[model samples]
Target: MEDFRKKLYEDIIIKQISRNNDVETAHKCIETLSRVVNNIIDSPNDERKRRLKEKSKTFQSNICGAQGGVEFLVKIGFRAKVIDFEKFYVLEHPLTDNPDSPEMEKLKVAQEILQDFLKKVKDRAELASKMQAKEKAAEELRRKAVLEKIDEDKERRVAARERLQARRKSQEEQETTINEESNSADDSADTADTTDTQSQPEQFYRAYHSSHYRQPNQKQD
Candidate 1:
């Protein structure tokens, strides 16, 4: 019968406790059991450590009300008892009496299991947190890089526009200077043509007079 009870309680710890509660609550339940086991192991002769009040708020919230909580205590040799009209679960055989017994061995194994589970859960949470932080930092770097690229593109466009505008202004100034020089050359050519036309009229008059007034000595031809 004791062996059967131990088997039943072990199954409860392995399956029911985690199934019935959220992870935080489940861990709390396991931690409570660990403390209880540690207390019993440390003070096997302490009557207080051997007994748990059924109606106590802490016991009800952390242990009795939790699935498989009562069963786990039972597996370690605790039994339901009534004392002075109040109810309690009391250890019948203090595990310290026979540390090498199967019950004591089972208790130690259960403690080991609980500790291992808690450590694994803690490690997983830390790993997840670190991954999230790394991802966030990477995202921030990507965002900054994108913004910098945009700014660089904008600056290049502005510089290109300014250069284009400067080139256009220089071309316009050169055209203006060439047009002014061409106009000055055209004016000088026109003035020289007018002066030549005036001189030609005076020369033509002198030639006509000289031809008419030929040498008087010359005989009529």
Candidate 2:
């Protein structure tokens, strides 16, 4: 497929130079034609390729097809002219004894310029693909880091909740212990007060009876 495309590009260059002998014009024509060629090369559209090749052979006047023989020469800025297609001047350009021909010289110059252009385009595309891959890798790393951070935060929160629960449980137990001790102390104080109250009444009653009996005995004496 790659070889086919290279041959196709070379054929288009030859055709463009043969028709107009202008490299700049030929380059522009190829620039427009590259889109269709690249698509066919990438996707392998047989029908499209066949149609494009057919279009290349047919000419409006003297101009060749700009893109895969489908696009018109006038569309690519070429003027129409009525010429005998059978008796056309076959100036063998870039690869013939007539290398010194003005048209052939133009073809050579155009070929060099287009080769450089295509190379730069290929290099830029490769660079773009690499950059996109790097971006995707960085994004994946960022996503993983976010997930890890979320897990760490969840674990920390769970630990914090457990610690809080434990502290609350301990505080509740301490409070319960204090309340029980207060109640026991209150009960002991109440029991002591009741015992003192009962003893005091008994002692008072005995003293009163003894005093009354002793006074009567003194009067009899």
Candidate 3:
């Protein structure tokens, strides 16, 4: 199929170009027309994009059929008079329904075959872009949620530490009061033990002296 299109492109299209329409212009025109046709093929019948291939196909069929005076030139092989162009150029655009031209059939078949693939590519590109945008939004939401959770956890930890410090300080003050009371009790016990020991010795000495007959010594004096 491709080989057939190449043959038509080279033999018919290339041959049609002349001093009036240089080969460069012929290339430019063919390329431009191809881009336009491809654009029509890429567009869909959907509301987002318009379809124009069917109309373009009809026009292209006429253009290739007329062949810029190449068809009849092939017919007579250099015997085509300039008068043939003047009259027959009209016939080529509105082809006389000639079935023998394989070039015509090849062109029509290529257009029909490309139609489906072009539409598929166009729709796929649009769908892919939509999917990407949706994914981006989801990712942003997830990131925000993660950051919020982290901040909440940090605040909770800070609050817990502060509560723990307050509890520890209160317990330390209670322990200090208990230790001071214990020291005061120990000091009082030591003072009571010292007074009891000194009073016991003095009471023993007075008892001994009273037992030694102090009344007799006072009568002698």
Name the best candidate (by TM-score): 1
1 or 2, greater by TM-score: 1
Q: How far is candidate 2 from the true structure (C-alpha RMSD, Å)?
A: 12.0
Q: Write the per-residue lDDT of candidate 2 for residues 1-221, one digit (tens) a residue.
A: 34433543455444444254333334444454444334333333243331232223333212343333332322222233224443221212123336574433443444444566555545655776788899999999999999999999999999999999999999999999999999999999999999888888443444446665575547753
Once all C-alphas are superposed, what RMSD does model 1 give against the true structure?
8.5
- lDDT of every model, 2 decimals: 0.78, 0.50, 0.47
Ranked candidates, highest TM-score first: 1, 2, 3
Q: Give the per-residue Cα lDDT of candidate 3 at 66.
A: 38
After superposing candidate 3, which stretches have Cα over 4 Å from the reference? 1-101, 112-116, 185-221
Ranking by lDDT: 1, 2, 3
Listed in order, each prediction's TM-score against the native is 0.50, 0.48, 0.42
Better candidate by lDDT, 1 or 3: 1
lDDT tens digits by residue: candidate 3, 9-89: 445444553223433344333443344334323432222122122224433443343344334223312122234233222
Off by over 4 Å in 1: 1-10, 121-221
